[model samples]
Target: MLCIYNLQLTQTHHFFHSKKGVPFADYQGICNWLTRLVQIENGKQLTCNRNFIAPLCELCCASSLQIGSLMHAFDSVKSALRVLEESVALNCEEETTKSCIQYLEAVPWDDSEEEEIVKVASRLGPIAMPIVARISPVDLTATRNVFLSALRFATSSPGGEGSGLPFGDELRTSAQEQIEYMLGEDEETPLVTADDEVRSVARAGLAQIFSSFQTIISCSLSETTETEALHIVSDLVWMCNVLPKMDMMKDFVVRWTEASIVEIIEDNRFESIVWGLKVKVIEVTVKVLEAVGYGTVILQPTLRVQLLRTWLPYIRKLKPILDAKAEQDPSFGHRMDEDLCQNIEGAIVSLILALPSNDQGEILAGWMSGEQVKFPDLSEAFEVWCYRTKSAKRRLVEGGLDRVGNGNGRIETTEMRDMTMIPSAMVLIADTDRKESLAVKGSRK
Candidate 1:
């Protein structure tokens, strides 16, 4: 019995001595050691001991670390989160996961370190979010709070000065790349399992981030100067372009349209903003409409009419600028013109097609008469409308329908020809008007 006791004592001493010899006193050493702990096959068993727990808690409490060290520390924290998630998934170790969460929650975040905080969040969010999403009932509130705090730091104007320039483009690019990697593209398989719980939690987290983003933009628009507002709007547009591409974020389209499009249109100050800012706003607006137009959600009739009223004037105002730029640099400017025109026309046509046939006819008639509405070029819009109508008719015919349209039976070939001829005539009229206007301007010049 004495010999057995001695052996046990020696083994315990050797184990602790080895662990104590590790330089957890230094941040880099702590990170390295924690990374190693994360890689261990039995991660839960390793993390349960005070040797690992105490040092992590100590590191979290440290307030004197520089920004560079904080970033490295966050990397280690991310690794630790991965380990905790894997351990819980493999062994249902709720206690270990809880302890890890508490340590992570203790980490102090300083608002003064905005850029560094953003860097850490952008890197850590992608990794930790997936794990938090997948793990079962592990109380990730503390972890999620950390992520939200980081995002708020990232999106807000630096130092509460309201400069509207959140950070450099590189940080935005890095955050976007990380989010893309986490969410994956529409065609690609998701990085996590398709479990309903996982998707639910992930969506909830994203919704929080988006809500925070909306709040930031609202505050910026109301409180900031024109230059600052431009900064905010530019960054918001970049985010809108990125977030809508995630396959799981279908609702982002509606939320973005409601927040940005509706708000911008209603803002009385919109017309007074700089012309360059107006163009950026229009670009983002068309992008939202195009993305959501492809989806099943139909815009309300009132909103559709409002959008037409708002965009038609903007398009007319933009035509001269586009024309001059295209004349100066045909390649780049024409490409921009074509892309913007296609997006706007496609979106408007989609909205028109969603309306009942009677409403569609009314809208078309209004455009043709230039009575209630006047657009820069109705030709492209009419072309898209004709093509969509033809496709619908073809599908009906292929399905063996003898007639199309509500209450009008047996549509004849002559009616189809008339449908095509009317738009062609309108196109000719529009072309004539445009040529005459250009000639008048040229003579004056």
Candidate 2:
């Protein structure tokens, strides 16, 4: 009774006209009073006026109503939480959301209180998603089952409205959101906490996705039926979107050509589905190359050479064809994504840069060789390689990478010729036979 009478003394509602908004100084007082209302030991809290929610929300945007201060009592916590949720920004710019997450993370559940929260969650929607997302883990089989369902919808062949059937864009939107959240690329924290665990979960999901790929390839081999060939290509590409971000998948990309269907890549004369699948292949190749190429996963010079050699010709040939098709018909689904092309160029440039100057020249000689297909425009890689070769020894001496510190307290200079991890952005002149190759590399175009 004393708490109710005291809170009523404060003119909490009149201070905000809904036009000028609540005065900033009044924020602390309102929060304090609300806490008192919830904290009252007498059951008067059950009957407190619920009318002030709107003006209260206005102040909540900048309120000092801490999450910890309310958790002691369910009535108090729920009352404060209702106001806090009204205030929390989706971008997490508000202090209330942060404190709430930390409190929920640290404290054990008030199951009865959370039942009310879960009810609030059902009505308020994704704004309440963070609590459910963070609180607990679902069954592994349940997780994999939903993933597989999304995988199926995603992998189904591109066709009419009837083909997509019950859930079209909504399923895709959910899958993409789920993927981003699982990968920790979402605005909220990753559903999985540890990086290793995230990767392990990701790899398990990738394996399930890729296992379907193996099935598709094996079944598609002899006849190349539409059902076999095209049905799962989208699934492969869908999973490819995940590949570049995984550090362990470098070997998968390096050894890719063995499992790859050469006919689809080699023969561009195929029908639209096959052509689309071809573009899908290039997309996957570009992603994996990025995984290994951009210093994400290190490879020996020989592996780097192999990676470039395997995919170079296919990309060189496919590049112009994709552009010409898109130019010829704007509606073509197999058209080149400008971003994918940019990644291809960038990934190739990094791989080329990692090699010896002579290998770079030889590899680049293959580029722009055919006048008809000068699509990738390797001039960036060529120019950077040339500049680095000329400045090799000087930059090596300057950066002190020319010699290595050994356990025996010795500095090694001559063995530095094999150093592959050159800092090309600043002073990346790999001493790996750069001196010997320059004369030979210089003589060529």
Candidate 3:
């Protein structure tokens, strides 16, 4: 009831400020009332009650209040911070801790002040790890700390204790949002530098996520409810999204295409717990492959092949099913928009063009034989692959050669007396008169 009243006061302040012409400072009486929620008397501290704990948290809340510097009494309030520190020390209720954390996160450190905020954040130790991520953008130490913390929740067991806890979900949700926002989610371009140091963070995070996924995957889906299973699927999708941003797409392909995950994917019984998960996995795979194939996410030749061979079958079978289902459906819950469909198709075609002819032939043959034939309609990749492979010799002869620089032919062979005869070959010819004379003499001889 006290927590509810505390929230109502903030709402009441907003109501007067927005509706009436009064400023937030007009609520000075209310602010002073809430500020005293945490106090000490007779050489003893108050605010032991859970209800007052949240109200004390609310007193220090409102980033705008701190930013506006209204209500001078609430401006430099340290009691809330004291309560928060004590709460963390006591390992208090999740709601109180979360509210305190939220209040700290809301503080306008960069805009208003930082001395006290940084001190509290540092004193809070690892519990304030996520706050450091938001408050300090260029602090790699804080970024790495948050990344490690994010990785911990990212790799947590699906049905573990944290899975059911309110604060645990907050942490997990914070983990997801922090990583994305830090990496530049809605921005025009990625904010991540992906430098050597950042890559190291990604590498370590990748290793832990792999180990956690591998461990949790061995547990039967029947052991978890649909919600829990979906949570794990969401984490895996989160992994998929983060990998491409960090230039770890190829690394992910190597791990996910391994037999352990394949066994789960191949077991496509409709009623089985794996079905929903399998579909979502393929959805993320399509996006991953799209990134890799479109060159947005660069990868080596080998991992591209692994991605195609492992997920192509599923992509082929599921594209139509995805098209048939609405996002409102429980079974196929994801929204596969038209742009996504085109992207996957184009990406598949791009990858197909990169493969050897024999492999393309095998993939195309399987596509033609199954119900998947008309779904992905890889005829774009198929037709292009055939023409590229069959006309390889002709195109090579016709397209001629690229002359990057006029340099001496390293081979020193006089076989090419007429450079025009080998338009197909990119023989680097140094424009040196001596080499040309030597080639002519050698050919004549």
lDDT of 1 by residue, 234-266 (tens): 655645654454344345545554555435433
TM-score of each: 0.41, 0.52, 0.52
Q: In model 1, which regions exceed 4 Å deviation?
A: 1-173, 185-224, 248-250, 259-272, 296-313, 317-338, 371-445
Which pairs clash inside model 1?
none
- For each predicted model, how many residue pairs clash, with residues at least 3 apart or on different chains? 0, 0, 3
| TM match of model 3 to true structure | 0.52
Instruction: Please report the TM-score between candidate 2 and the true structure.
Output: 0.52
Candidate 1: lDDT over CA atoms?
0.48
Encode model 3's per-residue lDDT on 1-445: one tens digit a residue.
4564546555654554354323444344545555464355456665545454444344334323432332332443354465567557645445555555655566555543456767878888887766556655455555565665665565566555487876877677777777776666533223343455556666665666566655555565564544565666677678777766666776665566554665554554433345566566666677767665655654454565777877777666666665566544666665455776777787787666555445567778877888767666687666555554555456445655322322442122233223322311211221132244455557879
The count of backbone overlaps in candidate 2 is 0
lDDT of 2 by residue, 1-445 (tens): 6555435433443333232332344445655656555555555445444455333544343343334443332234455455546545223335555555444434545778777766766776765677666455676556555654554444334342335557765565467557645555543233322245545555565555555565555443434554545545555565656544444465455446445555434643453345666777777778767766666666667776877787887777776777778789888767667788888887877778776667788888777576644467677677667666577668767878656654444343645535654324212443343444555668885
lDDT of 3: 0.57
CA shift of 28, model 3, Å: 18
Q: Where does candidate 3 stray beyond 4 Å?
A: 1-154, 158-165, 185-201, 211-219, 223-226, 268-274, 296-303, 319-340, 399-445
lDDT scores for all predictions? Answer: 0.48, 0.57, 0.57
Candidates, ranked, TM-score: 3, 2, 1
